[model samples]
Target: MKLSKNFTNPLAANNPVIVQILGICSALAVTVKMEPALVMGLSVTFVCAFSNLIMSLLRNGVPSRIRIIVQLVVIATLVIVVDQFLRAYMYDVSKQLSVYVGLIITNCIVMGRVEAFALGNKPWDAFVDGVANGLGYAFILVLVAFFRELFGSGELFGIEILGDWYTPNALMLFPPMALIIIGCIIWVHRTINKDLQEK
Candidate 1:
């Protein structure tokens, strides 16, 4: 794939969340609010990009029998680093993210790109792909978080947006609402891209 495509495609045409439907767990878990969602998104982006880069660099040297193990190690190391950084600086958000930060190690989006793209592509290309996909994931997360926080809590990033007269929808803060929001996003995306609906 061209470098531009590697960087741009995932933002829309190949979005990990809306298109590929990967990483939905974190999307639902952390998006009850915006701050944790933003933190989680950036942390995942960092992990995905660096892990892909490292995996690409080691692709040729990794023994076929142990490549998956090697990829997990790299991903785990990166996730630990991100977790530690969040703990140190964004302690509250870190606590809010809790296990989900560690769970990034198990995210299919990270593993899939590392195995399917980084293993066969150049390091830079892999890095771009990872970052692009991460951003795609982040974009949907933020979008969902925006609505959830806005309607669920009458706020955005903890700043109150709705007036005292406004009544928040309690259900919007729940996991089922996340699935509904994501479903709506997928519906709109497919509606706009008619080719995506063709079977």
Candidate 2:
């Protein structure tokens, strides 16, 4: 029951991508390849979840005026830790992701949730909400990456699927494609979850 809630909550209702429009920069940029996108997604999940937990723990004593600053320090520390870990163990992927990994510190999704949910919740519940939102953002990201990689490179997870004759579409690799795919996903998501549009 917990796993179901964790994995599925982000895909709709409180979807980080659609409902919140969080983390779209990474959603557009790193999604050119499946493996990289997956890694990016997981990294965001770890940072967001842990940062939420830590922030929730400190919420009570944090000065109301400095709460935003406190949240940034915690989030940045986690991003640096993740960056160092990725560099030491996964250098190639780290290089590909480049500044984007570091930029996670500024990702609105992280800060937005930290301020809105984490500060108000118990530590464990904050963690769950963070993971759920991160995964929800990732779900839309990966789904877009799935199509972009498949059509743009004729591959998924770096495996050729469209045969040799298929010429990959260069346009699909660009950010515009990400925007289009996200638009379509939003359209469909809103259609099914019509309450969002009404709101």
Candidate 3:
């Protein structure tokens, strides 16, 4: 149950990037390419999961007044570690993501999970919360990457999808298109998950 906890939350209701819209800025900015988006997703998942785990371990000792600062410290440390690892190993993807890797420190999703769920839960539950949110964000990031790459570049993971006659639209490569796609996704998702529709 401890391990499973780290894997499920992001798949459902409390998904950091989706239901809460926690990291849309980065989600939109880096999702134009599938490879870069995948790197970002994996990096975030690592940072979020470790941050939650560490934060949960320290939950008992941190004074209420200093909890936020402490959480940031933990998150920043993990983000930097992940960034350096990416630079050393996946240098190509790192170049594409550029400063966005460092910006993960400011990502509300990571900090939100640490503060909201990790702070109150045991280490196991916090790990699960982090994983779930990571998967949740990954799910949408991949989804957005799917459409963006397929149409913007006539490819998915860089393979042609539209065949010979199809012309890729340059607009789809721009960051603003992510907002339109995400809006449509929300529209369709709300239509399907009508229970979430604003009454």
Candidate 4:
């Protein structure tokens, strides 16, 4: 049951994006398009999950003074590997992602999990927490991208769903629109979780 909570909580109630607001930069940058947002989400998921597992395994041996450095080393290695894989397998999408892929190294969601949870939890639990938080972040990204791509471009994943008569909203493609979408998401999230609003 505890493991399930680790995996499930971040999906909604404890969502890293809507609640903690840890990874808003990528949320704003990548959601301009659906495909890049999806790729970025999966990349972040992989990095967070694996890094957490590795950190949990090494937690006992890591020197307290240098644990942050150690976590960075692990995270950087994973980010590089993810970047190389994207370049080789999905070159065009990777090009779209650009520096944002490398920026995953600086994503607070990744480091925060390692420092706050992985360092204290068992490997399996930490892995679950990482994946859940990654998905939480991804969920918001995909939601925002879906709206942005659909209304902004009159398409979904590059395929037009809106007919020729339908005109796209150029504002949805902008960074400010991402913020608006995110704000809407938070409003809805808090409305449903009234306990969050109480505090």
Candidate 5:
């Protein structure tokens, strides 16, 4: 039951993006298109999951004074691995992502989970929490990208979908539009999950 909650909570009630608003920068930056957004999401999920596991495994022996430094090293190492993997196999998408991939190292969701949850939990539980939080962030990214790419460019993944008859809305391509969409998402989400609303 505890493990299941760890895995499920972040997906909705405790979503890292919509509820906690933790990873809004990447969500806005990469969600210009579905392809990059999806890639970014997967990359984060992998890094978050493994970083938590590794940090949790090391939590015992690491000195409290150096805990943040150690956690950063672990997170940075994973970000490097992901960055290289993207460069090696997915060069085009990687080029599109640019430095945002490396920026994952500083993502609050990743570091926050390592400090907040992984430091206390067993490795397996920590891993699940990481995966759940990562997915929560990813879910918002992909959804925002879907609308932006479809309406902004009349395309999804670079293949035109809306056809020539449908005029692409240039405003949708901007960061402000992403924020508006995210705002709408937050409004609807809070409406359904009323507990998230301010008392």
Candidate 6:
């Protein structure tokens, strides 16, 4: 039951992107297109899952004072692996992602799970939590990208979806529009999960 909660809650109740509002930077930056958003999401998921497992495995040996530093090192190493893999096989998407791929080290979702859950949980449980959080974050990114790409360019993954008769809305491509979309998501999320609403 606990493991299921760890796997399920982040999808909505504790979503790192919309509920906890972590990793918003990448959510805004890489979500302009579906392909990049999907890549970015997978990158984050890999880093978060492994980082959590590693940290959980090392939790007992690491000195408390240096834990944060160690966590950064672990996360950075994983991010580097993901970045290089993308550069090697998906050069175009890598270029589209730019520094944001490296920036996964600093994504709140990665470090946040390490500090909050991995430090104390068993390795399997921590891994599941990390995967859940990563997926939750990805869900929002893809959803936002779906709207942005469709409306902004009348395409998905750069392939034309809407007929040319539909004029693309330029504003949908802008960062501010991503913010508004996120705001609407949060509003709707809070409305549905009354527990998240203010008392």
Clashes of 6: 0
What are the models' TM-scores? 0.98, 0.94, 0.93, 0.98, 0.98, 0.98
Local accuracy of candidate 2 as per-residue lDDT tens digits, 18-87 = 8888788889999898887888888898999999999999999999998989999999999999999999
Query: Residue 76 error for model 4, in Å?
Result: 0.6
Model 3 per-residue lDDT tens digits across residues 42-78: 8888898899999999999999998989988998999
Q: Can you list the residue pairs that collide in candidate 2?
A: none
* lDDT value, candidate 3, whole model: 0.85
* True lDDT of residue 105, candidate 4: 100
Clash pairs of candidate 4?
none
The lDDT values for all models are 0.94, 0.89, 0.85, 0.95, 0.95, 0.94
Better of 3 and 6 by TM-score: 6
Off by over 4 Å in 5: none
For residues 93-154, write the lDDT of model 4, one tens digit per residue: 99999999999999999999999999999999999999999989888899999999999999
Candidate no. 5 TM-score: 0.98
Q: How much is 109 displaced in model 2, in angstroms?
A: 0.8
Residue range 12-131, candidate 5, lDDT tens digits? 999999988898988889999999999999999999999999999998999999999999999999999999999999999999999999999989999999999999999999999999
lDDT score of residue 135 within candidate 5: 92
lDDT of predicted model 1: 0.94
Give the residue spans of candidate 2 off by over 4 A.
1-8
Tens digits of per-residue lDDT, candidate 1, 38-77, equal: 9888888999999999999999999999999999999999
Can you give the lDDT of residue 124 in candidate 1? 92
